[model samples]
Target: MVYDFDKLWNYNKPADTEMAFLKLLPKALECGTDYHLQLLTQIARTQGLQQQFDRAHHTLDEVEKQLNTQAFPQAAIRYLLERGRVFNSSGNKKDAAPLFEQAWQLASETGNDFYAADALHMLAIVASPEQALEWNLKALHLAENSADTRTQKWLGSLYNNIGWTYFDMADYEKALALFEKCLQWNEKQHHPMEVFIARWSAGKTLRLLQRTEEALHTQTGLLKEMIDKNMEEDGFVFEELAECLLQLNRPEQAKKYFAAAYNLLSKDIWLQKNEPARLSRLQKLG
Candidate 1:
């Protein structure tokens, strides 16, 4: 309760967040309620986010050493969940699934529906599309039924993931529906960043569905909202708007947004790696 891991939640830079967690560890240890171990769990998570897999593994080992299955049910579930997450993030879903399943079992036994839903959600992520949908639906059911506020907040994430899975499988209608659901849940949270993300997904899905005008409208509105709120400027939205304009034959507007997107996104290593072709086209437009 005293240790605020929430501070790390919105930090996009995992390496910096990991350092922040490390700085808090000694002070957290003095609190004397296995708080240090909980902090270690978060540190391991940040290491995984930073792609420091081996260091993340070592941190989890330390967690394993301190974890008591009987005495700390919640912590035990978190340890297993974090272990599964590390393996999942490291691209070892085969190893990850069992850990998530075990965590699910532990959470169920402990009557912790929030963690149980989380394990199911992770299982969905690492599974095949059809199996993933099944798992996701089950997780959604648990989340919806739980009285815990944390579980309720998971609605947006579950919808977003399922939406993307549908999108990847080329089911645009289903994807759009789920993305809309995500947007609805995010609106309830009134978290600007999350709402932006949900809108982005919805707009992208609209583009995939060839609803160019709708996609353009959605992205345009979202961009204005972000600008008004001084929210994190997402290059993806600009790129999406550009593409939508291009599809609608507004070449001049498209070119402008393409240039804007290029200026913002060209430095992103992940974009450079995964979307080189699209980036190249954006550059050509610029």
Candidate 2:
């Protein structure tokens, strides 16, 4: 646990994650302890951030070797979730399905409702748009059964996710309503990530509505917050904001945003050569 937390703080989304390797002793990990599983999960997450997919799986395997199935059902659920996440990240949704199912089943049988709900949430992400609603609604059911405030917040995130899925499925009316309600949960929690995501979603849906000026105003705040936090902004976010700017007949402002987005992404050598949208936008600006 100490090691994991230390690594998180030191990195704190630091760049060049492949160069950020700090090895942990296998013996330091005591299976079934909250900290142990947390360490394993963090290592997996770190590898994912570094884009080292195989390394992440190897770390999970180490944790698996130490965990006993009979004694650690909750941990079992966690392991499956982590593995499923890696598969999802790697774009291997089919491989992730069974893992999520196993975790969901274990969480249910063990009365670990929160874990069950979490599994359902991730499972829904991998499912098709048509099938996703069932998974999310099932997750909501399990979440409703829990008494924890944190659990409720998670369920709220699940709802937000469902709303996004609906939006992707071309159901704007449903998406807007769900997102509006999810804002209440985020307000109560007042977490940065939640606020950031909620605003992003709102702005996105408004754009779909052709409410260009409103969407620009909404995302502008989020952009300032991201900059203030010194966090990396997704190029897609900036591109979308520029789209709104163009719709608002603000090509000058659009040029600024387009440049900013392309520049930020262009710093990464790999993406500089690879991202046609950003690169082409820059060329167009020039």
- Shift of residue 270 alpha carbon in model 1, Å: 3.7
Query: RMSD, each candidate, Å?
Result: 2.3, 4.0
**Which structure among the candidates has the greatest lDDT?**
1
Best by TM-score: 1
Q: RMSD (Cα, Å) of candidate 1?
A: 2.3
Candidate 1 lDDT over residue span 1-286, tens digit each: 5867646753588888888888888788687646777788888888888778899999999989888889878778888898999998777999999999999999999889888999999999989999999999999898888999888878888999899889888999999999888888888878767778888888988988898888999999998988888877888999999999999888998998999899899988667766898889999996
TM-score of each: 0.89, 0.80
RMSD score of candidate 2 (Å): 4.0
| Model 2: CA > 4 A from native | 1-38, 223-237, 266-286
Candidate 2 C-alpha lDDT tens digits along 1-286: 3544433433446233333434443544443365576566666766765566898899889778877656877667778888888888777899999999999998889887777888899889999987888899888876776886546657668869889888989898789777876776777777667667777787889889887778888888778877888877766568668878888888897887778777666666446545667577665762
